[model samples]
Target chain A: MTDESRPGVGPVSLATVAAQAGVSIATVSRIVNGETRRASAETVERVRQAIKAVGYHPNQLGRALRNRESRLVAMLAANLDNPVMATIAASTEAALRQAGYVMILCDTHDRPDLQDDYLNAMRSQVVQGYVMVASQPSPGLRDFVERGAPMVFVSRRSPFGECSFVGPDNIAAGSAAADYLLDRSIEEPAVVYPSRESSTTRERVKGFCDRVIARGIPADRIRRADGPGISHLEIGYAAAQHFSAPHAWPRGAMCISDQVAYGVHRLARESGVQIPHDCEIVGIDGSPLNAWLAPWLTSVEIPHPEFGPSIVELLVSLWGGEPPREHLMPHRLAAALER
Target chain B: MTDESRPGVGPVSLATVAAQAGVSIATVSRIVNGETRRASAETVERVRQAIKAVGYHPNQLGRALRNRESRLVAMLAANLDNPVMATIAASTEAALRQAGYVMILCDTHDRPDLQDDYLNAMRSQVVQGYVMVASQPSPGLRDFVERGAPMVFVSRRSPFGECSFVGPDNIAAGSAAADYLLDRSIEEPAVVYPSRESSTTRERVKGFCDRVIARGIPADRIRRADGPGISHLEIGYAAAQHFSAPHAWPRGAMCISDQVAYGVHRLARESGVQIPHDCEIVGIDGSPLNAWLAPWLTSVEIPHPEFGPSIVELLVSLWGGEPPREHLMPHRLAAALER
Candidate 1:
């Protein structure tokens, strides 16, 4: 039982306890595996004492295989480096733990090959379900969908459209961003985005463009700055080159995300372009940290804290054989409008 | 085997494939589990064909139990909401994946109770090893250490001083910060920290205070500001109140982390104090994002990217039965001092 006694020996096993208790291995196995009905009460007590004496650790892997349940849930995220994704991951992990499931997080790094590898690995591990965050369509994902796997997509919808989704109404968020800028007397506001590859970004851009054009702002007058869709900060920093000049700057600008907005702000400062006085900027992804770390940024806030419980609820419903449904969480502009 | 034909049917099992192949279940299991040497070539061919036809997925849980290897690693982090932690998690996950292991992340939220729960849960799941990030000593942790579990502490050393550690040299980083400020002709400087509960913060503060005092500054003039140790940003923001006024402002300041430095900067700007000109500030945790998003923050950069591979390597060494060792990664100042 003590380290001093077991110098280079392997972990204590059922056989060791069985030998120590003067019982058959079957009796020890039955007692250790919770099949005590097969053994007498006195025999079970003897086996328990032997197990404690030998420091026997039950093999959960064997138990999980026999029960056909690992109680392991996998979360395949596009990137964990993003604050939004990290926030969602933290909340989801807490929620999963509360539900008696351990969450296995795999970062796909936004690569299809990596996603495929993680999916295959998680499948082999026999995870009960999955939560995909900003996932992309891959053959492995399609196979999971075809096989009727329980999954929920967060911050993005499944391209296959069969799984449940939990995210903000990004289109409405974009429209709100546009309206906020226009209401501040800024005409010909610019919209900066990394790429339209993601549904969130594509829909947000669509909503902003449609609303601005409907309000009589000429399509050509509304500047649209797009970048290589890599790092959000890099995208915003690159976009700033086209708008940092006093003559080129729009009276107002909306960035795809808070990180991008920060990039724009950093570049503008370096370029001697004063915010509010020269041009106002707004961002999305109202991360809670912004309240203390980034008070200057005005953004449409997504309910990141609710994402964990909502996603878990949707996943549990899926497990109960409920029809897949979409859950659209609300978004609102955060921070004061005044410069 | 198709979804339509197998409507309401359970997943294909080894027996299903064995029946389809006209072979014993044991024979089919052998071929599927990569023990083809036990079966004839024709039998292996038949089992492979039947597996494809019946859409059977091997139960890795069973094989893992037999092999005594789960290929599962758990990472226990204090907080994931912090960008530094998020960056480390992403890189660590990638490195783990590259090593053919899946990482299950557990956020302890800096609570010992949560840490205990995660430790117990991970133990039940039979993780091969652990990577503790800013871990606090707990009974479960002590049990693991006593039992000789393979674990490595990242960003902080084990409070028990019995496990491998992979992190930056905090003392050197703090000394670098002090020298950076002193070289800039700032006679009086302030140090803002959340708490000294963590080894990283404690060492950094000790290094800064020691170096400054050795260089002839009075210990009382060091102006150490400590907060409730809840939120790093709030700590910095609160500390800023003591130095916002012109009479109270030190010519220079050193913050615990980049997040805390951002809080100070935000507060100073609101209080009409200009950075660099009013009070030169330095921060630790040179997050890669700072290059594009926070060009104004001069920080001592910890090589976040290198942490992943280094931690993985240390864990592998421990698994190989090597003695526990400490890895102190190098740190240096990032960005221009002219800011």
Candidate 2:
């Protein structure tokens, strides 16, 4: 792209101005972004003229160069398509903005390499800190933490426990989903779960299984189906196709997420199965987008009203060299919210 | 945030390394990131030891500083919550990455000032180029365009046509929506449109009205509803409430977006109105997320399979200083797509 097209790339450097003015790039930068005290009046005029002629731009980089700080925080999200994650990112950005810190967003799409790249790039750029919503774990992130990089994790924790985390109580959310199914007299239930590569899903499934076994339900009775290949829809379809059979489908199902629920519902309709009547479905994360659809995706919502602000606060604490803390937000089922 | 919490901000400058090593920061920087030929072996060792002692982190900034360039492209989107926008963003990011550039995302939340802030910040950070989906027009964007900052407009044209754009032909989409409604034998068709701040909405409304008038339908017969307090549901709820007043409701309504159609469907259902049988609705930008819901929110499907790649190519052309080209991607109604 033309120099103009590349706005994110560094603009014409002070060196260009210096070359035109017969001065130094350092001289030009000092005169442009910082105090022009070191340069003589004649030299300053020459540098200014050269800068104007070269179309040189001096921005935050000048200030950052002098102070050696960018005062910027970035949030590495796994995917922006997920409304729940999007909400968290928005709130975090807003909270950071209000606190006079600019937020840079990078979505990794669950690729560990991409996650590492963003982390490395941001570090190279001298971003102040980061808040990560680890859709998937990245060893690169762990390296940063090991190197004493300040970070706050959300939705997923650092596998090594070297960082602070503020996230939902998945165990509670899973238990609520289980209790709802048991109360509905669903004797045989199935769990449509994504890969256990995700800690959140693992915790949720564990909580659910513990609750079910405690209620005297045999572990063998509860069917576990691999929900989706990626935990969005197609995988849910696969899981639904596997679990749903004539007179053999589970009476109730706990989905990894509402997205999985949507897929299950679509698959069931295609198969001519009735929801609630034949099989009831409950999922986690009652996303706002679900409100657009009929028969609201009954979900257990993890209360995260303070998620954004709390994470920001946690980052601040980390900056102050505080020990890493695991903060769990509460959760509630949709029915409980109404009551 | 503390000094350590902010890894992105300038971490341990050459000055610190110099102070520890009893040398100049510039000398330290040159030896550490640049050439070390000027510095003696002992001196370089002292600088290195100091750097390690001070916890100085040398990252990507060192490379960027020397070259004054970073291959980064940014997409300024209005909202990530909308799956349509998210899809576009994901595609664009993937395309950019494929072309050996990193994509930085900034969601404007449909606010002009925030958009401006991101633009300014990106500029300060020396980003190479930008692809804008103008949520709202602000002089700041126009100023950048006039200054000839490489920009590519998506979904909207630059108010001051100094840049290239890649988007759908909204006029034809609107005409198609009108023709479909007319073919259904609806006479009293009303247009549920948001404020004409968006050129996309303006073009769609104009085409619909022009087509209706050409079809011998009285221009006055087709009513228009105020469609936004915000583009998605709340205003749609308001429009639905206004339209469904006993005998006043329009027999057919052309909504500005599928989101608006969804809101109308919800409001109608609450009022016990049968869809298609009593009221037929059509909207624009058939989002993939809409498929999850029952009774599909029929819309004009703008063929954007190449949106991400096409726009990336357009930006590449702009970077090459090619003339600004207005690229109109094709579109078809959802009904037409099925056929």
Candidate 3:
């Protein structure tokens, strides 16, 4: 039989797609959203049959209007000057654009009140999803989630069980840095990273600490320093000042972010401490600019590009009525600076 | 004493404020928008009195809703990785926030189609104002302007004459850079900047070139090269490669952006061009992190903090119904990286 002669042949709309597919409108919406559910063989077959019978291409904006959805995604960033966050925002936006969505970029500047305000403001915008990078969610965030807008956390972990997350494997990143430093036979390693409070910083430190302990390094042999989470370079300089003094320095060091690594480089140069020879160093977040930094950053490559795809998958699934889950993407330890 | 007994006592709506203040509501709105208008001393006093008497806090949001006006401002940026734009966005947002407004940031990634799409989307949102930083204005941009959203160009100058603009004094920055380089007595000079098509880059180059010509050096004597606008380090590397040949190289150079300066530094180092001795360089946009780059960056400081106040002044003025005009902010060149 010719394609046009098939039964249930018609133009695809919410109604026709639902009826011919033998499913409810909500089910069709869920299927389109890519929700996690196993449809019955017969129902799935019917839907597939209907979809094929009528070339139904759902109008994103039309559906959004009907649901009062903005089709606009909000990305809350704590700081953009931090290359890591910039990279994350750029990649995430790129992904969002491909998925037929416009992202509203909001910089919270690590202020609780501002963060709350943006969250509150977002509530009236009819936004479909939210993406936050290393931001501390406030009461407004909970209210937003309750309003049925799916949210994804990037570079930050949320205590809220319902929100999905996409970020680098911080634990592995830390462990790899330790291994890199130790592989070069640096016994006493010092770790300097941003904010002692940030989960990202803590996770990296944890991995490095675990690995250093696993390698038989004494607890006292490892030194730790914390600085402003976003201003890694500033912290690196501070760490360097302490390290430059004869009694204050550690034998080896790993920076929490590439920006901090840049600071360490400057300090080492100013103090005449040769990298890898004086104090081997590594940074995380593997910004592309690291390649051009003076000594080229020996950093953990946190698949910044993959963030775009991963975020889309999560958002699409959520829109499809799927439950939220945390996703951890693997990182590559680029020892570019070592050579 | 009763409100009537007081000098400021009256019916304090538009009429009272107008009657007591001896100014029209339009004038009050203009003052609120930060427009520079000459209101009589008595009028100013009366307006203040009327405002205080009636507690006339402008309901920006409420007014917007009733009139189908979106007090939301849309900012179209090419890239957030460029810290300058981020700083500007942050500053602008802060200014708008104080006025009970929020900014919608869209990254066009230098694509005309994306810019068009974003413009259309912003139009649909009924944004009160628009700010764009784009090197080239597409057809969609023209259409957007015609559709009647008051827009101000930042950094990027549009070919159209109708739009208002807010940008740094590029000529001053360039001359300042040249002055710094010459004060150091580096005779042979090279220039590395983004593509000449960029308004800022062109302005900087013209200023620098003019200074060089005035110093009795022929225009052709300057070693100049333009690279892909995206990567700063690449431009730096290219500069280094050009100057670090086995033969003679320029003794000094100025980069368009700090990111580009980093690249130049890397290339110079790789080519064994010693900074401040064999070569010295200056960069634009004095980012805080510039000091962290190895050897730091000698850059022209653009006042990022003031961006918020300036943008708000312009936006509020437009909101109050003023015609478009240009505003220029000054810059200072600082010796960030000195040997």
The DockQ scores of all candidates, in the order shown, are: 0.45, 0.40, 0.13
Q: Candidate 2's error at B151, in angstroms?
A: 0.8
> How are the candidates ranked when ordered by DockQ, highest leading?
1, 2, 3
- lDDT by residue (B61-129, candidate 3, tens digit) is 334434556557888888776778878888887788888888888888877788878876665554667
Q: What is the lDDT of residue A154 in candidate 2?
A: 95
Tell me the tens digit of each residue's lDDT in model 1 across A90-156.
8999898899888888899888888888887777776778899999889878877777788899998
Q: Candidate 3 regions off by >4 Å? A: A1-66, A145-148, A228-230, A239-244, B1-66, B244-246, B294-296
lDDT of 1 by residue, B204-299 (tens): 888888888878888888887766666887878887887747668887999978888877877887777778678888899997756654566789
lDDT ranking, high to low: 1, 2, 3
Q: Clash number for every model?
A: 0, 32, 8
lDDT of 3 by residue, A1-339 (tens): 233221111113557678777679887777766652766666666776776565454544344434545567888888876767777888888888888888888889887788878865764455667887877857756544554457788888764555788998898999999999899888888898765468887888899999999999988888887665446777777766756574456767888778788887777767777765666778888778666654556888888878878988898887787888778999887776434
Residue B251 CA displacement from its true place in model 1, Å:
1.6
Runs in model 2 with CA error above 4 Å?
A1-58, A303-306, A336-339, B1-59, B62-66, B246-248, B336-339
Q: Which ten residues in a row have the lowest lDDT in candidate 2 chain B?
A: B1-10
Model 1, residue B262: what's the lDDT? 77
Sorted into a CAPRI-style docking class, model 2 comes out as acceptable
- What is the Cα-based lDDT of residue A246 in candidate 1? 64
lDDT value, residue B49 of candidate 1: 92
